[model samples]
Target: MASDMESDIALHLKADYFDFFDLSIEKIIGSGSTGDVVLAVHNTYPDINRAVKRFSLKEEDLQKRNISLERVKKLFYHEVEMVRDLDHPNIVRRSNGIVCPGYLAIAMDYCPLGTLVDHLKKMTSERIDKFFPGVVAGVEYLHSLRIVHGDIKLQNIFINADNEAVLGDFGVSFKMPENVQGVKSVGSTMGYFAPEVLKKKPSVDPFKCDSYAVGVVLRCLVKRRRPGYTSDYMEEIRSTKMEDKFRYFLERLLCRDPCKRSTMSEVQRSLIEFTPDRYTLELSRKRCLEDISNSSMPQQKKPTHKRSASSSS
Candidate 1:
């Protein structure tokens, strides 16, 4: 049966997600995230597009650890199962999973605007108010599904052409069962991990860990400044008795005690009410666009027209 399944997948090598949905694949608008092998594949049949994530546990680090191939396969399968059960607009929609000989991959919705990290790098303080609510909404939606998005960072949040934010990259996500203990080093990035995780505390809640990461992301976006280790700026976050609205929100998210931090729902509510003035929004957008335009991506060439008189020969 496994052999037959492999043969079936082989037949659909270049098939797009829409093909399974009874649609076509032809209008892919953009592509990014080469590290994870993410691509924007469009469905020409239905005039739609989606993101495709190809999973391959071929990392040198894992291979060096001498982990069993079967164990890696099990981890991939677990991610697929978790993604299949999730349903939320803020979260990228998982369309389907396909297994080919020695590989596995999943299809999901695409966002053309770009990554939140990229967007934040270009923007000023003024534009954050308009752009951040969508991010908060996405996080809130994920929590509603009872799934802890173990890696909630700027890179994983995508922005659509319409400026809507969608959460992506569930490579480290899992559902929380009641009375469950924490997972160790599941999918955390250095410097962004919660204090409890760094200390390896017992009974650490995955949901709280996610909140802490979210706080870091929010700070990075709002401040437009990257706080390095040993920087006095971190003191503002570490010492949290202040009453500034943004500061308060950050304090709650980065709270030492998980029980004292704000819930995803509460974070979403606060974001909605914390609107910035219009001038700030416009200025930030302008600055962000300029920065993006100056980045390494090549500038598109202008089109030119030519006469066809030479064809008479």
Candidate 2:
């Protein structure tokens, strides 16, 4: 809610965040490269649930990473402070933070439905379309504050009890430098890398990079598959059977030329004017079932030649 993103916040002070809450060891909800998240309950508010993430780093881990304990602490609090200060409906809320001897812990709103990755099997055109706006709103809010999410992916997007998409994981986030057009560093997520990033260009626009990642995340959810590393996914989008508006929207986001890429503002504006066509997986499945039921052709006979074979060779 604060327009000034750089304003100092008092949330990340070292304290016993868990002293007032109870963690359910049995309910370990999430595990990732940095740490594991478990379900937590406030001591006074027994009915409410939260996700407590405990970041882990041992002596060798620190040595291998070439980072000091103080540096790790600063980075951990950096993420916590960003999430704690942000007040947006589509962004996950952080409540508390604590630093221990070797690791740190933070508590946040618990989205019972889990993340987008958990619902890959249930994702459809409608579901993907429904959450598209929330992602945009969250990113829009971040950009409004001059902050970049740095990482946006299915695993980082959570679905709450209300089934609304909310963004999480600000560990890799950074504030866009004042008056600066672009930054030299970015998050290390490969599939979500923008054209400028993939090309290993020195200076990359953080805002455009985030927009590119949003497109990839949307594509993976709608397709119910992992984001691919191919550079020509736009061609695949064109060849696929989807609404014209929807197809064009994706093409613009995935455009190889940064100058021609669609910004989040443009995307939000387009959505306001038109609602794209919804997808129907049942129709596709039914057609496939009908073809199989009507034909006796063996699967192996469909293709006769080896893809790698060359007569001249």
C-alpha lDDT values of all predictions: 0.63, 0.76
194: Cα error in model 1, Å: 0.6
Mark the regions of model 1 whose C-alpha exceeds 4 Å error after superposition.
2-36, 40-48, 57-68, 181-187, 225-244, 275-313
Q: Considering every candidate listed, which one attains the maximal lDDT?
A: 2
Clashing residue pairs in candidate 2 are none
Indicate the residue-level lDDT of 264 in model 2: 88
lDDT by residue for model 1 (13-129), tens:
444333445544444433322214455444443445566655444566346655566665555566666667667666676556665444456666777787776676677555565
**Model 1 clashes, total count:** 5
- The positional error of residue 185 in candidate 2, measured at the CA in angstroms, is 3.5
Q: After superposition, how far is residue 13 of candidate 2 from its true place, in Å?
A: 8.7
Candidate 2 lDDT over 59-142, as tens digits, reads 776776566766766667788777777898899875566655456777788998888888988888778778888998899899
